[model samples]
Target: MSFSDAIKICFQKYMDFNGRAKRPEFWWFALFCVVVSLVLGMASSALSTLFSLATLLPSLAVGARRLHDTNRSGWLQLLWIIPLIGWIIMIVFLAQQGSSEDNQYGSTPAN
Candidate 1:
């Protein structure tokens, strides 16, 4: 998916954690979040903090969906608490291609 579309979908699904998100969708939205946060931070710390808080739910939801696409539980996100290895493992999992066929979470997202 294109960056704008991904970001739009993420906002539309804000607070929704029950589906699968394709790699592009997740990554593009992630990029949007990072860029916006950095830009806003440079302009005003308060604006950046507000922006981060506003986007946090959608970010987490999309991330959960990304994990679902990999046939993993959303709870796995908690592994980030473990430091470097956990962060790396999470990245690897998120980077993995979704199963072409359905697993437990749901059918593969349409390309």
Candidate 2:
């Protein structure tokens, strides 16, 4: 998907974790989130508290979709409970490429 489309979908689904996402879609949205967070952090120091709290949902949504992209369940996030191993596994999973075509989750991301 295009960068703009990814950002749009990220917010459109904001909290959805059911569908699959491709690498471009996931990473671009991630970049959007990071940049937005930094900008918001600088622009509204007083509001940082609220923005920080609010960012959690979309961040989770992106992470969940990133998991789905790798053909893993979003529930894998719970693995974070297992000390360092879980975080490593999550990083590796996020780094891996999505299936080239469709898998059980859904169709390939829009071209």
Candidate 3:
């Protein structure tokens, strides 16, 4: 998915954690968030903080959905607490392609 479409879908489903999110959607939105955060931080700390707070939930929701797409539980995100290795593992999980066949999560998201 394109960056704008990913961001739009993320915000539209801001609090939703039940569906699946494709790799492109999740990664594009992630890049958007990082770029926005960096730009806002360069402009003003307060603006950056506000943006981070505002996007937190949507980020988590999309992340959870992304995990679901990999056939993993959203709760697995807690592994990030484990430091470097944990972060690497989470990245690997999130970067993986979704299962071709449906598992416990919903059907594959349409491209």
Candidate 4:
């Protein structure tokens, strides 16, 4: 997916994490998130400390949507609670192919 498409998906789903996401869709959005955070973080760190908090909500929302695209419950994302293992698991899921033709959430990303 294109960067614009990924960002659109991020906001469209917002908090939904029960579908499947293709690789481009996930990574592009992720890149956007990181770039945004870095810029905002630098601004906050140098200017108002409080602005650093900006990344929190956006990050969660994007993460939840990314999980949804994976066909996994957003709740499963909490698996990141386990630290390294959780992180590894989440990465694996993101790396896996989306449902071939939609398992239950909606339609296949390929379609």
lDDT of 4: 0.66
Off by over 4 Å in 2: 43-45, 80-84
> Each model's RMSD to truth, in Å?
0.9, 2.3, 0.7, 3.2
**Residue 57 shift from truth in candidate 2, angstroms:** 1.8
TM-score of 3: 0.97
Name the runs in model 3 displaced over 4 angstroms. none
TM-score of 4: 0.71
State the lDDT at 83 in candidate 2: 92
Which tens-of-lDDT digit does each residue in 6-88 have in candidate 4?
Answer: 87876676555555666777778778776776776666755333433543454466565456666777677788789899899
Instruction: Judge candidate 3 at residue 16 and give its lDDT.
Output: 98
Better of 1 and 2 by TM-score: 1
Per-model clash counts, in order, read 0, 0, 0, 6
CA-lDDT, candidates in order: 0.93, 0.79, 0.94, 0.66
Candidate 3 C-alpha RMSD relative to the actual structure: 0.7
lDDT of 2 by residue, 21-105 (tens): 7777778977876787788778896566577677678768877887887888888888878899988987788889888777777
Count steric clashes of candidate 1: 0
Model 4 ranges off by over 4 Å: 15-19, 46-65
Candidate numbers, best lDDT first, in rank order: 3, 1, 2, 4
Model 1, CA-based lDDT: 0.93
Q: State the lDDT at 21 in candidate 1.
A: 93
Per-residue lDDT of model 1, residues 1-111, tens digit only = 788899999999998999899999999998999999999999999999999999989989999999999999999999889999999999999999988888788888887
